[model samples]
Target: INIIMDTLAGLAFAGEAALSRYMLEKPIPKDEQLISEDMWASILINGSVAALASLFFLNYAPIRELFSRGMPIESEKAEAIFLTAFFGFFVFMHAFNTFNARTQGLNLFEHILENKLFLGIIFLIFTVQTTFIYIGGDVLRTVPLEPMEWLYMVMFALVLIPVDLVRKWVRNVWFGNPVQTRVNQ
Candidate 1:
């Protein structure tokens, strides 16, 4: 089941890559000139390289142990499946996110800075909360693992998956209409 899911995720990533390429090759209006072949190529190459480096780094004992977190033995097959799905989703997410920002008329630098700040704050909050919970008391004993975490994660991902739809909606309602907002200089 996990392998099948992982394969599906990989296929999805491949589809996203193809879609990005297609978007790059198409003509973009002056107001929506964000998707470019150079940008897509850079993203694709860098993402693939990062994934490869992560896979190689995971072989190191320290890195492996860090991820293991003193947990008991799990199936190696499951680990591979998890890793595959992780990378696949990561690639697709990055592609979709950049595509969304481009289609939104957001400058790359500003968009990245904003997103990094948001992610950093979320990471800090989660880290501090988890640390305090562990230090202050054994909350893990009282709170059993719930499927809600998985559900929330899935929902979070699904929200991003509609980037193209949102772009189309925005264009149709806001920009794609006959009304031009520019002033003649």
Candidate 2:
């Protein structure tokens, strides 16, 4: 399952890379070039989606039950920890990926809007997953999760975005030519 999922994610990333290249081929006006605001917007949008998914679905009983169903593990705490770690890592990974993909090595913001279709697909996938885990509890052999668990998941998942943003800022200050060039004039 991990292999399959990783393959699918790799494919999705390849698609995003193709889209980014295609978009970059277009001629963009100087005034419409990437700005700091656009970078912030991209970070906020992607980060918020990841945080929400972690908060709402990570420790949800249904998802936990789904994992616990085949295992001989009897402790709910163990299940919760496993699921939290698994989903939390996923949420952070995707959020970081979003930041990397949006920047696309140029540290530009235009790529973010250029790949709206990809972002929408991500949103759709999350929605479908949430629905499946929530509504298919009986068939999936999962249980609903408590609100507190959701909170914990969210808090853990929320750290990645700010860290990435700071990294971007540092890059901008030391290695970024775009922002500095614009400011020098």
Candidate 3:
């Protein structure tokens, strides 16, 4: 599963087109660090936010009951709703990382729609992952989740975007703005 996810990620990241911001930024020197401090800020902050949110969904009661399907909750059932939510978001957070990884800076949505391949790959990831929850049954250890469960999960994972935006804003506040040479200005 991890391999599959990484492959999808590679495809999504590679397909992103050059954005206008690319024109404004100065080129990196040959000896510069591969990952900048800003990138690390985003990596730590957004990744922590997503992981914490997934753990929250795992413990949230309403979600547990919603996915439980009348199975006795305290009985340590294998297909419990809370567990289901965890698995869904496990796949979802990885699926959604495409958005977080899309940008060198914070404006992830800039020129977003211009890349049809990225959009399609994301669609494939989400659609297939959800479908697996329904059809995977014993192999996937998933109980069928209602559509509302899915909506809640997707919206829940969507919080990564706002969390990242705030992370970027805070980065600018403490570390100063990104050094973009305003070339062709």
Candidate 4:
């Protein structure tokens, strides 16, 4: 998780342009924590969503059949293919969550392309992950997935986009900007 999610995601986040509004806010006091309550809220909620999805996918039944295409699930090759899909799903899920993790704002794509390095890294992450699914073969215990299967996993993982967006909108409307509050701890 750390290597796959953090390296590229962190780079993308680190590339975000600092808002000029940051200059207007009062300087954080020494004793106060940098992360605010709003951040904690988004973090906990989105993180929980990802964790739950992971727990949900760690199974072997109907889902495996969907990926099995035709091979008997009991066969070693079918098991490898199942494992491959499972791993691929896990990677793509985190990749989708990366967009959510980068912001507390309502617009997940706001100014995303403005950061060229960030965009490049995101594209790179996707490309490399896809390549891994194909070339990874025996060593990585992966098999190339069909296009529709790839789409299925991505579409399912993308559930986080709306979920996080709603969470952000609700927080923005009912709660307010996270940066306005302070965490003394």
Candidate closest to the true structure, highest lDDT: 4
Candidate 2 worst ten-residue window by lDDT: 1-10
Candidate 4 lDDT over 61-118, as tens digits, reads 7777777878897888778777777777777777877777766676778678778877
Residue ranges of candidate 4 with Cα displaced over 4 Å:
179-185
- Report lDDT (CA) for all predictions: 0.39, 0.52, 0.72, 0.76
Q: After superposition, how far is residue 178 of candidate 3 from its true place, in Å?
A: 2.0
- C-alpha TM-score for every candidate: 0.28, 0.46, 0.82, 0.87
The alpha-carbon deviation from the true structure for residue 15 of candidate 4, after best TM-score superposition, in angstroms, is 1.6
List the RMSD of every prediction in angstroms.
14.5, 10.1, 2.8, 3.2
Candidate 3, residue 45: the lDDT equals 83
Which tens-of-lDDT digit does each residue in 50-158 have in candidate 3? 7788777777777677656577666556345556667777778777767877765677776788888888888888777777777877787776777877777677767
lDDT, candidate 1, at 97: 49
Question: Which pairs of residues clash in candidate 4, taking residues 3 or more apart in a chain or in different chains?
Answer: none
lDDT of 2 by residue, 1-185 (tens): 24323543454455454443444454557898575654664568656765676565554666454445355435865564445445434644563455454442445354555666556655554554445434545564434444555454445555555655666666566767443444354
Highest TM-score scorer? 4
Worst-scoring 10-residue span by lDDT in model 3: 176-185
